[model samples]
Target chain A: MTKTKKIPVSLTLASNRDKSDHLAGFLSISPWLIGFILLILGPMLASLYLSFTDYNLLSSPSWVGLANYRSLLTDARFLKSLEVTFTFVFVSVPLKLIFALALAMLFNTGRKGSSFFSAVYYIPSIIGGSVAIAVVWKQLFGRQGAVTQILSLLNITDANLIGNPDTALSVLILLVIWQFGSPMIIFLAGLRQIPIELYEAASVDGASKWRQFFNITLPMLTPVIFFNLVMQTIQGFMTFTQAYLITGGGPLDETLFYAVYLYETAFEYLRMGYASAMAWVLLIIIAVITLIFFLTSKYWVFYQSEGGR
Target chain B: MHSNKRLLSDMIFYVFVIAIGIVMIYPILWMIASSLKPATEIFNNAVSLWPSAFVWENYPSGWAGFGGIGFATYFRNSVMITSIVVVGTLLTGSIVAYGFARLEFKMKNILFACLMATIMLPIQITLIPQYIIFNEIGWVNTFYPLLLPGLMGGQPFFIFLLIQFIRGIPRELDEAAIVDGCSKLGIYWRIILPLLKPALVTVALFCFMWTWDDFLAPLIYLNDASLHTVTIALRNFMDTQGSTSWGPLLAMSSLSLLPQLLIFAFFQKHLVQGIATTGLK
Candidate 1:
């Protein structure tokens, strides 16, 4: 009888401790929980609702039932922005990845002074998104700017690259491709994670350097490549400050990125409802592209832990 | 003969690398060189990296700033916002990470997944509604819109990063603290936080750089001219005076980049490590 009474008391004490732990856990994470609801989750739901309405900041929203999305299909600038953004993402991401991978291989050779070189290469990536760089780029590609002058020295006189419709998007692409340092750093880390023994074993089997690289390095680096591809693709689609500051999405809207167009729609024109719709469309586009990447990743991406399966 | 061939290849490699490095760094050098050049020389001598004469006046003139508001004001504003945001990110990020990393509760898996999902969610989705909400609260024009987000656990990336770091720490430390009559919060403060210094430094440095370089938030929220951050002021300076004075514009631009360069120079190890770890994971 005494043992049974003691057991019930101990059970109650353990229950009380568990309740306190649950409370503490909730309390500890309350800031992020509150933020996620207020800033992300709540806002996401509100935007979804607003996307189907006609609302400006000055007045209340009126339900319109997908009119904004319908109008989007007919919007020339919206279509153009999509084309420009798609072109930018497709062209820049691969070029950036290639450069990053190649340079990472060079640095991974374990040569003296590689770290210093890496640091030097990283400066542009650090500040390339700044207005200062964009401003400088505009001047650099202007009619009498340094690049034009240098081109004239070569007797290849072309008009201001920024002002030319055909070249404007390419200029922005080149600017982004120049800042491949971050991915290169990531690639470097990934390369280091690849074991030297693989290369050694390949060499022992009388494999040529090119053969070793194709068979081992390339397959091993697929996961890192996928990560870089996904990140750079997302970033490339959202290319803004460069296009906004340098070209102002101009030369007949050839450089109009989606985010720049969205900003113009929302703040510049104050068409909050339409902009919200555009935002959802963009979210959907990113989601679809990311999903495609994940689905395709299994075919190419190699995990050593899975024993090459 | 083999040693001689190897030496020759090394020489070729160094030359090639140096040449590429020059091309990479030339634009920045040109911007700095242009800032010190005379107005006439800016365009005419654009190809030349070395100015015939250094115009010391550009610094002072740029410091004088546009419309009676100086660059000093913008710099001060940036420093204030950046410092507070850094502190807030550390505090909130650590607290939230500890909860996720150490504590067990109902729906922890779901909440954790939600945290991960937000890391990939684009800001554009929430931008409009957030603006409307803040506007309704009469907080649109104030720094509250800018400051509150940082205080409210900042970016999910930093929180995730801290969680990763916290998980690597052994649970034995926490158990010992509990045995010593420590509360959960006490264990966090006395044990986890002290052990989390390296990761905190990484988070702090990133918070400082990103907050300092942030343009969009300050652009949307701080509409008053006097309330402008360096980025906004720089853009406005270009709009009003870009064509008239390239020297001062470039000079001010260079000034705006100084803090970033200084941090990169000093804390490069932390920055590189942060990127590598995040990418690998």
Candidate 2:
């Protein structure tokens, strides 16, 4: 913290010259400051403005106020994608939390090789969102895949799992669920932070393992649970890769997620304006959901310590 | 509580947990085993726990340039992009995270909020616009677009995470440095950067894996086969019609996963910390 250029903390309040010095003090943080202006802040505001325009890259964006929004409200594909995305988040997020929580509880036994188990479980989470893993999933469930070949053992010759509309979405869901390692690992960490003596005391009080889990672990883990739920929910809503690479959002759009459809609309069809509008709506939806979660957090989220609960 | 019932419940829990683990790992294990098996042996053999032949030559065949060109060059591209992204993300993201975490500034809170806000915006809306922007800049087929975004706070999540970690460090340290006539830059360089090693390592490792595994960005930007990342290379191992020599593709994919594995193997604890502290716990 040695100064080549120092802003004196005791600068006189009576001088306009000190303000210029403070400005210089601010100028030192130019990397993030300039980046925010040039990249993120600028693009975000532009995206908002772009949402109301008819800019399709070839022509100048003419202001068409609220037209994009109006059309999107009735756009069937957009609505379908909304439903698909909602279904995805609605199903996957809760299941993810539950599975992750369960896995964490099991691993929290402080077993030997626990670290290795944790790492192994986390490996899928690392690559799960990528298109490569999704592609591997596509191949695994393809007609000539391991799953299909396994099914052929039962003489079910026509079990094309990835192609079937009924099963395709579920496959993606399973993929999402399989990557429970992120939350599971986080939950394990949270569980470790919880004092083990509480569980030991509960056992001494003759409480069963399930009772101890319900009575002790659940309440203690709520804050971590809440955080994971919000993050995973947002991530689940924005899922694109699995459906994109696997089903291509096909077999009658069963797997056509909001982001995938938005990507298809924007990139495949050059509907940047419509896509921008969709992006805004998505932003609003996510904002509202986050706001709701934050608002309700006071009611349920428990922070443990000498601090508070 | 009934002791017998409790015992039965624990037994059931263990059963349930083990069952779930098998199902969870089965597909990935299947991929590994299949990649080792010969082409004819893939389906002819039952989908069991392990592969029989363990033909390691699939790695070389797969790495050898496909269509008279192979994954050798593609692996290089993947390496290049991943390395660039790693450096870019650490350099830019740490600087920005440092700004938000330690440095006081004008509208600092507002700008940090804006960074968080970008987290939820779908990348699709930007893809075509960014693509056209890149096209106009004559960078559509170049690695610039693929690599440069990482240099910005394009990845806000890691920045936010580092900010949280930075906030955990005592400000008194910086104040002490100030008393010793240290500059703010000196505070960041000596006090903050060294202390922020765990978070920085977490950020760098995740960036490496993320950029390496990212098919979409490279898929969109690097259209030239010569410039293809591993993901695109794996895709090219197949055709539009589906089902041709995927064994080698899967084998090469197994190879592609090596970087991530190496990352995890070396930095397991930091990675665990990352998973735990990636703004959740």
- Identify the candidate with maximal DockQ: 1
Q: Positional deviation of A116 in candidate 1, in angstroms?
A: 0.8
Give the DockQ (C-alpha) for candidate 1: 0.71
What are the clash counts of all predictions, listed in order?
0, 10
Highest-lDDT candidate: 1
- iRMSD in angstroms, per model: 1.6, 3.1
Error of 2 at A36 (Å): 2.5
Residue-level lDDT of model 2, residues B1-281, one tens digit each, is 69998788677766766676677677667767777887777656736646776887667877785766677788888888888778877777766777777665567667667777766655654555566667778998899988777767437777787788889999999989989988767888889889988888888887777778786777777777888887877766754323666677678767777777777778878888777767532
lDDT of 2 at A35: 59
Native contact fraction (fnat) of model 2: 0.33
lDDT of 1 by residue, A184-214 (tens): 9999999999989999999999999899888
Q: What is the lDDT of residue A7 in candidate 2?
A: 60
Go through the candidates in order and give the C-alpha RMSD of each one to the true structure. Answer: 2.2, 4.3
Correct interface contacts retained, every candidate: 0.69, 0.33
Summing lDDT over every window of 10 consecutive residues in candidate 2 chain B, give the lowest-scoring window. B238-247
True contacts kept of 1: 0.69
The C-alpha stretches of model 1 lying farther than 4 A from their native spots are A1-7
**Which of the CAPRI classes, incorrect, acceptable, medium or high, describes model 2?**
acceptable
> Chain B, TM-score, each prediction?
0.97, 0.91
